[model samples]
Target: MIIQMEGISKSFSGNQVLKEVAFSLEKGEIHALMGENGAGKSTMMKILTGIYARDSGTVEVKGKQVVYKGPKDAERDGIAVIHQELNILPELTVAENLYLGNEQTVGKTAWLKTKEMNRKTEETLRDLGLHVKATERAGNLSVGKQQMIEIAKALMTNADVIIMDEPTAALTDREIQTLFKTIRGLQEKGVSFIYISHRMEEIFSLCDRITVLRDGQYVGVKNIPETSFDEIVSMMVGRQLGGRFPELTNEPGDVKLEVKGLTRMGEFKDISFAVKSGEILGISGLMGAGRSEVVETLFGYRKAESGQILINGKEVQISSPIEAIRNGLGLITEDRKTKGLITDFSIRENISLANLKSISTNGWIAKKKESALFENLIKRLRVVCSSPEQQAKSLSGGNQQKVVIAKWLGTSPSILILDEPTRGVDVGAKKEIYTIMKELAEQGVAIIMVSSELPEVIGMSSRVMVMFEGQMKTILDRNELSEEHIMHYATGGDKHVG
Candidate 1:
């Protein structure tokens, strides 16, 4: 075995998050660690990487017991962790970011060997099938490229056992394939990996063995070939989940929102689409194909150089978010940590932020009104938390996303735009989100979902709009929706296939 942990237990502030969990990874194996939000998957890995000291446990590396004081100690022992949120300085060049703190120097002096480092960076990236200039700024690259950079860092450290958390959450399809290829190549070289992701399809296809965790306790471990998706999901949630996606029963009504000639120069151009009162319009494309940009323009976050936005058959000039809200538009932004919530605030505070005017009495806020709103939303959304007073940042990613949705639901929008609604969420949470969207749609709310996941777009959308190079290529009916068809339009392929 490459590593093993038994009887692991941990807690924070008397709240037990992990209890007697056990895991094992063999050399050159891709092991998947899976659970719902707050299920102790991350905690177990943290303890393994020395980010958190376990209260009680035994961890063995290559048959020797070891307790690492910190991540550096673990790294020195050939264990590296690449977190979900990448650690890359945007302003720094790729070479600089790659060689950070371990830069090559000239003959024991402070002068750097920039040329040599850049050459090495290019070579390393090329090995991983990533083609980019080493001198270019790291931030300019797509999320996928930045992720590859993190893996490159791990390889440079000669890490034998690497742990990746939600690695493909923001990657395009091509990028995911590239990442999978790189991982398989590394595995062939005897580099074992612990892959953490909520994507079941990915785990089933790429991983060799799977270990399931539920509510901080060890569930069971099974070989990928021996286990089924239904069994793994049942193991994770402790019950059978009826369907992968809930039934969409919302019937289409009149067009509630329309955009004609929506132009944003370099971002998107001449986008035209209409969403009915009770319809779900899905937007699908590659990373920079302007899926989010179109929604952002509609929400008044970006100014449209030329466009006519009609809501309820009346043209409205929405120049700001305040105006968008006034015109009955609610946007759940893509980046929840930065754009959706105040991380430092409590759940009640975050939920009431968008509808402060409604929850407030004159100039002052009404505590009772805010509390009632918080209670109602949490119960309705089934957000798991200690209390409404719990800090937003302390909640799991799935709960944090619920709070963002709750914040917007308070506005009671006639038109709702959700961007990557279940990007980093687990299968259980994803069903809950889909249920909520279905309920909203049934109540006559027009929803525009911008998603990269083709299955989600195909499953939920009443009509799908595919974009390519910032322009609307083709919009397909629900019957015509398929991964191949969407990719054809998304990649600027000819509309009529031969």
Candidate 2:
């Protein structure tokens, strides 16, 4: 075995997160770690990477028992981790970020060997099939590109065992293919990987063995060839998920929002669509197909060069987020960590931020009313947190998403625009979010959702709109929705359907 952890236990403020969990990885093997958010997957991995010390356990690397004091120590012992959240400094160049702490020095002086570092960074990027320049600013690159840089950083360590947490969450399908190729190449070179991802397809395709964790306890491990996807999901969720999406009973009502000839030059042009009250209009397309751009225009985040927006059959001008909110429109942005929530603030503060006017009287805040509002939202959304005062960043990815939903729900908008609502959440959380959308639709709120996952779009949408190369290819009804059909239009294979 390349790595083995047994009888691991950990807790935070008397709340047990992991309870005697056991895991093992073999040399040159791609092992999958499956779990829902807050299921102790991150905690277990953190312990392995020396970010957290286990309360009780034994960790052995290559048959040698060792305890690392920090991440550097773990890296020295041939273990490296690519965290879910991007960890590169925005101010630094790609090469600088890659060799951050382990910089090359010239002749024992404090001066750095800039040329050597850039050359090594270029070599690593080329090896990984990433087309980013070593001297380019990290912040200027797209999320997908930044993700590649993170992988390159991990590979630079030359570790025998690597832990990847949601490594492809921000990547496009093409980038994902490149990553898979890289993983296979590394495996051929005798490097092992502990892959953590919620996407079942990725696990089934890349992993040799799968280990399940639930509520901070080890469930079981199975060989990829012997176990089925349904069985794995049942183990992680502790119950059968009856369906991928809930059945919609509520019918769409009269038009609540309509966009006509919305144009943004190169981003998107002549975009037109209408969403009725109690309807979910799904926007589906490939990455950079201008889905986000169109939605941002509707939400007042981007200026529309020429367009007409009508709410309740009356034209309204929405030039900013504040204006959109005041006009009864709410947007749940795609990138939740950076664009949606204030990570440093408490849950109560975030939930109350959107609708401050409703919770305030005479320009003075109403403390009791605010507390009551937050309490109700917390219980309604099933957000798992110790208290309302807990920082938003402290919650798991699933819980943070719920908080984002709650923040918008607080505004009591008639139209809600959700962009990749369940992007990084778990299946259980996805189900809960779908349920919430259904409930909200039943309450007469129109929903316009933008998603990259075709299953999600087809399953939840009343109608799916396909976009290709910044133009509307087709709008598919429920009866016409299928992965092949959607992809055909999204990839510009067909443009005549409506």
Which residue pairs clash in candidate 1? Answer: none
**Candidate 1: tens digits of C-alpha lDDT, residues 1-498:** 989999999999999999999999999999999999889988899899888999998999989999989998888899988887668898999999888878999999999999999999999988877789999999887665787788788778878999999888876776687778989988999999999999998999899999999999999999999989999999999888898887887678999999899999998999999999989999999878888878988988989999899998999999999999999999988777767889999998888889898889987899888888888889887788998889998888778888999889988999999998887788888988899899999999999998878889998999999999899998999889899989888889988773
lDDT for 116 (candidate 2): 87
Model 2 backbone overlap count: 0
Q: What is the C-alpha RMSD of each candidate to the true structure, in Å?
A: 1.9, 2.4
Give the distance in Å from residue 195's predicted Cα in candidate 1 to where it truly belongs: 0.9
Model 2 TM-score on a 0 to 1 scale: 0.92
User: What does the lDDT read for residue 68 in candidate 2?
Assistant: 83
